[model samples]
Target: MIWHHLFQPFIEFGFMRRALVVCLALSVSTTALGVFLLLRRMSLMGDALSHAILPGVAVGYLLSGMSLLAMTLGGFIAGIAVALTAGLVSRRTPLREDASFAGFYLGSLALGVTLVSLRGSSVDLLHLLFGSILAVDNDAALFVCGVASLTLLSLALCYRGLVSEAFDSAFLEVNARRLPSLLHGLFLALLVLNLVASFQVLGTLMAVGVMMLPAVAARCWVRTLPGLLLLAALGGALSAWLGLSLSWSAGLPAGPAIVLTASLLFFISVLCGTRSRLADGLRAFFN
Candidate 1:
C-alpha cells in the first residue's frame, strides 16, 4: 500500500519524477544561499528580489511570447540590476540596504504586474505567479541543474570572502577591498540565477518560500553556519518529497503543497527544535 501510494506515482508518471528532480536540485543552492542571506540579515532582501523579477518576466513574455529562455534571462538581468542598485544606494546614500531593496522591488513589482496584465491571459498569469512544476520539461531540468551546479561551485570558491563579508568586514582588509563588489555581485548573481531557476519550477513566491522556510527552521536547530546549511538542505529535500506526495494524492496545487510542507517543517522545528526553544520558553514562564 505504501509503495502503491508513493512509489507508484513516481514510477508511473514522468511528470511526477521531474517535479521531484526539480525540488532536489533546488534544495542544494537555495538552502545555502538562504542561510547566507539570513546571516547577513537580508532575509527580507530575498523577498524584495523575488518580487523585483516580475517586471523582467513580463517584459520577456511580451517580447518573446512564452519563451522560457527569454523570460529567465530577462528576470535574471532584472534581479541583478535590483541587487546592484540596492547595494549601491546603501553604500552611497543615507538609505539602508533593506530600505533601498524595498523601494526598488515594490516599484519593479508594480511595473511587472502592470506589464503582464496588459498582454497575457489569466492562465499565463497563473503560470507566472505560481509556476507549473509538473510541466517542467527536460530542457528546463537541465537548466535548473546547471544553475545549481554553478551556484554551488561559485560559492565554494568564494567561501572565504563571503564569510568575511558576513561576519568580519573589518578583517576583510586588502583582498576584500580589491574586489570591492565583485564577490558581492557574484553572490547576487547566484541569488538571481536561483530565483530564475526556481521561478520556472515553483514560481516566484513558492520558490522564495521554500528557500526561506528551510533555512529559518535549520537556524532554530543549529548555531553554526555549516550546520544550518546542512540541516536546511535535508529539510528542503524532505519537504519536496512530502509536497510531491501530497500533491499527487490530494490533488492540491504543487507550489502551495511544497511550500506548505516546508512551513510545517518550520513550525515543527520552532516547537521541538534541538535548541529546546519551546521548553525553555515554558520554563521561563513558570519561573
Candidate 2:
C-alpha cells in the first residue's frame, strides 16, 4: 500500500510520467555540470547566469508569445552574450570577473522583468519565473531531453580539459596554451545551455538550485571527482522523485517542491556526512 501510494499517481497520469523522465534526465546532466562548477569555485556564477538569460526569454516571448523554440533560442543567445561580455570586460578592464558578471546579470534581470511586465500578463510572467512542470507538454519534454543528452555528451568530451582547468588553471595555461581559454568558453556555453533547458522545468530563478545543491550535498560525502558526480546525480534524481510525490500528495507546486527537496538533502548531508566539517569537529570533540 505504501508503494501503491507512491507509484499510483505516476502510473495513472501521463504528465507525472513525463515529469519523472525529464527530471531524471536533468538530474543526470545538470548535476554533473554542477560538480565541475563547485570544484572551480564558480557556484555563484551559475546563479548569475541564470538571471542573465531573462532578458532574452522576455524578448522571445515578445516576438512569439509562449513559443518554446523562440524562448530557448533567445535565452541561449542572451546567456552566451552575457558570459562572453563579462569575460571580455574582466580581461580588458580592471574590474574583477565576478563583479562584471554580477553587474551584467543584475541589469539583465531588471530589463527582463520590465519587458515582461510591459507586454505579458501576470500569469505569463509567473509561468516564466516559476515554471509549471506538471503542465509540461510533449514538445517541452523532448526539448529538455535533447538538451540533457547534449550536456552529458559534452561533459564526456571535455572531461579531461574541464578537470584540468578546475584543478590547476596555471598548469593548464602554461602547458596547454590556448586550451584553458577554449575550455572556459566551452564550459560556459554548456552551463548556459543547461540553465536554459532547466528554466523550462524549474524556472530561471530556481534552476541553479537544482544544479548546485545536489553537487554541494555530494561533496560532503565524496572526495573524488567521479564519486562526487555519481552521488550528485543520484541525489538530483532522488529529489525529483520525492519532490514530485510530495507535490502530488499535498497539492504543492512542483518546481519549488523539487528544489526544496534538494535543499533538504543538502542540509541533511551537512549534518551527517562523514567528510563534512561538522562531522569532523564532532568526532574530535567526542574523542
Candidate 3:
C-alpha cells in the first residue's frame, strides 16, 4: 500500500506526471547550455540571470492571470535585459564581465523582491522564490517542451557559428562573412530560454546552481565536449529523479532538494574523478 501510494502519485496525479516530464526536458537543455557556459567562463552569469528574472516574473504575474506563461516571458525578458546591461557596462567601464553581472543581478534581484512584496501575498512570493513541483500543470509542461525544442534546434542549427565565436571571436570576425555579434546574441537568447524553463523546477536562485554544478562535475571526468555534455545531462536527470523522490518522502521543497542533489554530485565528482585536480594532488601526495 505504501509503495502503491508513493508510485501512484506519478500515475494518478496529472501534475506529478507533468512535473516529471518538464523536469526531464529541462535537464537536457540546461545540461547542454551548462557545458558551453562553463567553457566560456560565464557560469556565474547563469545564477545572475536566474535572479534577474524575478522582476519580470512579478510583472508577468501582475499583467496576466496565467502564472506559467507570464513568468516564462517575464523571466526571459529580464534575463536578456540584465545580460545586455551587463555587457554595456563592461564595454563602457573597466569592470570585468563577472563583476558587472554580479552588480546588475544583485540589484535586479532586490528590485524584483521589493516589487513582489508590494503586489503579491507572502505565499505567492515564497512560491516564486522556492517553487512547487506539485503545482505544475499541463500548460507548464507544454511550455517546457516548447522551450526545450527551440533550444535544441537553435543549438544544432548554429553549432558551427557558435563554436567559432566561442573559440575565437576575432578569428571568426576576420574569416567569416557572418557577424560574430549575431551568434553571440543567439547564444544569449538560448541561455535565457534555458534559464526560464529551469526556473519552474529550480526556482530563480537554485536554477543556476543546478545548471552549473553538474556541468562542472562532469568536466572533472570528461575531456571532450560531447562527453561532457552527456555526463552533465546524466547528472542533471539523476539529480531531478532523486530530488523529487526525496522531496516526496521527506515533505521538503523540491527545487532546493534537486539543487542540493546536484551539488552533492559535484562534490563527489571533485573528490573521486580520475581527471580531477584533486585526484592529481592526492595521487602526488600518496606517491
Candidate 4:
C-alpha cells in the first residue's frame, strides 16, 4: 500500500530511486551545515571550499581510477588545507578572511581544471562539473548517510558551543576559554563532510548555492536559529523534490535544475518574506 507512489519510480527505473535518495541526503546534510555557516557570516566559504576541492578530486580520479571514497577523501583534505591556510593568512597578514578564501579557492579551481584537462576527457570534466545523481550507487549512498548521521550527531553535541561562538564569540572567548575555537573547528569539519556528500549530486559549483541560498532565504523570514534551520531544510528538501520531478519530466540535467529551483525559491522568499526589503517597504507605504 505504502509503496504504490514511490514504487512506480523506484521499481520502474533504478536511476529514479538513486536520484531521489541522493538528492534527499544532499538536502538534509547541506542545509544542516548551512545554518551554522549563515550565522558565522561565512556563507561564501561554502562556494570557496566547493571550488577548492576540485583539484583534489581530479587528483583522486587520476590516482585511484574514480573511486568515490578516494575522491571524497581527496576533496576533504583539500578543503581542510584551504581552510587552515586561509586562517593562517588572515591571522598573519593584512588580508581579510574573505579575500584569503577567494584567493585560495579560485587558485585551486584553476589548478584543478588544468589538471583535469591534461589527463581527463571532455566527458570526465563535464561529469566533475555537473555530476550525475542517477549514477549514485549503494556505496555512495551509504557513505552519504554515514556522513549525514555523523554531522547531525556532532552538531547536536556541540550545539551550545556552536551557538555561543556564532552569536557571541567574545563571550565564549572570555567565559568558555577554548570552546569558541573548538566550535569553529567542528563547523569546518561539518562543512567538509557536507561538501563530500553533496559533490556527487550537486557537483562543486551548484553545491554551495544549494547549501547557502535556501538558508539565506529562510533567514529573511525566521528570527530564531532553530526555526531558520528547519525552514532552510524544508526549502532545500522542497527544491530537491521539485527539481527531480521537473528534470525527470523535461529530460533536463538534475543538478542545475535543482539549483535553479532553489534560486527561484530564494527570490520568492526575498519578495514575500516578512523581513524582506520588499515586504518591509510595502508595509511602510501602506501604514
Candidate 5:
C-alpha cells in the first residue's frame, strides 16, 4: 500500500517518470555545487546568479518563443556576462564583490521582467518564474541529464582546486599563480550551467532554493565536507521525491512544492541542529 502509493505515479505516467529522473539528477548536481558555494560563503550568490539569467532567458523567449535551446544559450551567456562583470567591478573598484553582484543582479532581473512582460503574457511569465516540471519533454529531459552529467564530471576534475580555494585561497594563489582564477571562472561557469539547467526544472526564482537549502540543511547535520556533500545530495533527492509526491497528491505546483519541501527540511534541521556546527558556520558566513 505505502509502496504502491509512492511508486505508482512514476510507473503509470511518463511525465512523472521524467520528472523523477530530472529531479534526482538535479538534486545530486545542484546540492553538490551548493556545498562548495556554502563553504565559499557564496551561498546567496547562487540566488543572485539565478536571477541574473532572467534577461537572457527573456531575450531568448522574445526571439524564439519557448525554444529550450535558445533560452539555455541565452541564459548561459547572460549569467556568465553578469558574473564576469561583477568580478571585474570588484577587482577594479573599491566596491566589494557581494555589492557588485547585488547591483548587477537587480538590474538584470528588472530588465528580464520587463522584457518578459513586453512580449509574453502573465501566464508565460509565471511559467518562466515557477517552471512546469511535469511538462518535461524528451528534449528537455535529455538536456537536463546531459547538464547534470557534465556538472558532476567538472566538479570531479576541479575538486582539489575548489577545496583549496575555498579553505585557503591565498595558499592556492601562492602555489599556483593562475589556478585560483581559473578555478573561479570554471566554478562560475558550472554555477551558471546548473542554474540554467535548474531553471528548466524549478524556474529561475525557485531554482537556487533547491540548490542552497539542502546544502544548508545538510550542514546542520554534518561537520565534514564529504559528509556535507553526501547529506546534501540525499536531502535534495528526498526533497525531489517528497515534493513530487506532494504535488501529485495535492495537485499543487511541482516546482514550489519541491522548494517548500526543501524549506521544510531546512526548518527541521534548524530545530534539531541547535548548537551544532551549522550555527557557527552560518555565523562566520554572514560575518
Candidate 6:
C-alpha cells in the first residue's frame, strides 16, 4: 500500500516522471553550488542574484515576445552583468559587496517589473515571477539538463580554487590557477545559469529557495565543507520527493511545495543537529 501510493502518480503520469528527473538534477546543481556560496559567506547573494535576472528576462520577453530561449539567454547575460558590476563597485567604492548587490538588484528588479508591465498582463507577470512548472515542455527541460551538466562540470574543475578562496583569500591568491576574480566570475556564471534554469521550475522569485534551504539545512548538521555539500544534496533529494508527493495529493503548486518541504527539513535539522553526530559520521565517510 505504501509503495503503491508513493509511486503511483509517477507511474501513471509522464509529467510527474519528468518533474522528478528535473527536480533531482536541479537539486544537485543548486545545492552543490550553494555549499560554496555558504562557505564563502555569500548566502544572501543568492537572493540578490536571483532577482537580478528579472530585468534581463523582461527585456528578452519584450524583444522576442516570450520566446523561452531568448528570455533565458537575456536573463543569464543580465545576471552576469549585475554580478560583475556589483563586484567592481564594491572594490572601487566605499560600499560593501552586500550593499552594492542590494542596490543593483533593487534597480534591476524595478526595471524588470516596469518592463513586464508595459506589454504583459498580470497573468504573464505572475507566470514570470511565480513560474508554471506544470506547463514546462521538453525544450525547457532539455535546456535545464544542459545547464545542470555545465554547472557540475565547471564546479568540478574549479573545486580547489573555490575552496581555497572561500577559506583564505590570501592563500588562494597564491595558489589558484586563475586569479580569484576569474573564479568569482565563473561562480557567478554558474549562479545565474542555475537561476535561469530554476525559473522554469520555481519562478525567479522562488527558485532561490531551492538553492538556499537545502544548503542551510545541511549546514545545521555538518562541520566540514564536503560533508555540507553531500548532506545538502541529500536534503535537496528529500525535498524533491516529499514536495512532489504533497503537490500530487494536495493539488498545490509544485515549486512552492518543494521549497516548503526543504524549509521543513531545515527546521528539523536545526532541532535535531545540536551535537552533529550524524554530520560527524558523514565527515568520516568522506574522509
Q: All candidates' TM-scores?
A: 0.95, 0.96, 0.92, 0.93, 0.94, 0.92
Q: Give the candidate number with the greatest TM-score.
A: 2
Q: List all candidate RMSDs to the true structure.
A: 1.6, 1.6, 2.4, 2.8, 3.9, 5.0
lDDT by residue for model 5 over 1-287, one digit each (tens)? Answer: 66665788989998999999999999999999999999999888999999999999999999999999999999999999999999999999999999999999999999999999998999999888888899988998999899889999999988988999999999999999999999999999999999999998789998999999999999888888988999999999999999998899888999999999999999889867753655567788999
User: What is the Cα-based TM-score of model 3?
Assistant: 0.92
Q: How many residue pairs clash in each candidate?
A: 0, 0, 0, 0, 0, 0
Off by over 4 Å in 2: 277-287
- Per-residue lDDT tens digits for candidate 6, residues 100-219, read 999999999899999999999999898888887767779888988888899989988989888888888787777655688888888888999999999877788888888989998888
Question: Candidate 2 lDDT, tens digit per residue, 63-141?
Answer: 9999999999999999999999999999999999899999999999999989999999999888888888988899999
| Pick by TM-score: 1 or 4, better one | 1
- Candidate 3 regions exceeding 4 Å error are 1-12, 277-287
Model 1 ranges off by over 4 Å: 283-287
Which is superior by TM-score, 3 or 5? 5
lDDT string for model 1 (37-83, tens) is: 99888898778889889899999999999898999989998998888
TM-score of 5: 0.94
Q: Compose the digit string of candidate 3's lDDT tens values, residues 78-154.
A: 88988898999999999998999999889889988888887789887877787766687777778878888998898
lDDT of 5: 0.93
Residue-level lDDT of model 4, residues 125-190, one tens digit each, is: 888888877788888888887887888788888888888888889988999788777778778878
Whole-model lDDT, candidate 1? 0.88
